[model samples]
Target: MVLERFDAIVFDWDGTLLDSTAAIAGAIRGAAADLGLPDPGPERAAQV
Candidate 1:
């Protein structure tokens, strides 16, 4: 099979390009808890 190349490629940021804000925040919180650190909430994580 041959692949076709397109001249223009449109991408979506918020939904398509892995906008996992909540997942990242949860993972950070879990990791912090595991390492005995404060639970940085979603807002804080996003800021960082």
Candidate 2:
């Protein structure tokens, strides 16, 4: 086997790359709810 190298690499901060925002937000809300805290809601959870 051989290894190859790339000259440039790019990263995307938006959800387009990983698209795990909703999962992350849901986890946050679930954790908060488990702790008896009010749900931050979708919009607020995204911000967090």
Candidate 3:
């Protein structure tokens, strides 16, 4: 059997390397508010 080697491997997490954190959190909060639910706040929204 033969084995191969890779020079590099990459891994990413959702929203880890992007600038959409605030936008996403805002959307969540907005949707909740529109439905007359309480705002999740930025920290909770981000965690969701």
lDDT of 1 by residue, 1-48 (tens): 999999998878665888777877788888999999987877897664
* Clashing pairs for predicted structure model 1, backbone only: none
The TM-score-based order of candidates, best leading, equals: 2, 3, 1
Measured over all alpha carbons after superposition, the RMSD of each candidate to the real structure, in angstroms, is 4.7, 4.2, 5.7
Candidate 1 global TM-score: 0.54
User: What lDDT tens digits, residue by residue, belong to model 2 across residues 1-48?
Assistant: 999999999898567677888898999999999999999999999887
Candidate 1 Cα outliers beyond 4 Å, as residue runs: 1-18
In terms of TM-score, which candidate is stronger, 2 or 3? 2
TM-score per candidate, chains pooled: 0.54, 0.63, 0.60
Ranking by lDDT: 2, 3, 1
- Say which prediction, candidate 1 or candidate 3, comes out ahead on TM-score: 3
Better of 2 and 3 by lDDT: 2
lDDT by residue (1-48, candidate 3, tens digit) is 899999998867555776678888999999999999999899999876
Per model, how many backbone clashes are there? 0, 0, 0
For TM-score, candidate 1 versus 2, the one ahead is: 2
lDDT of 1: 0.80
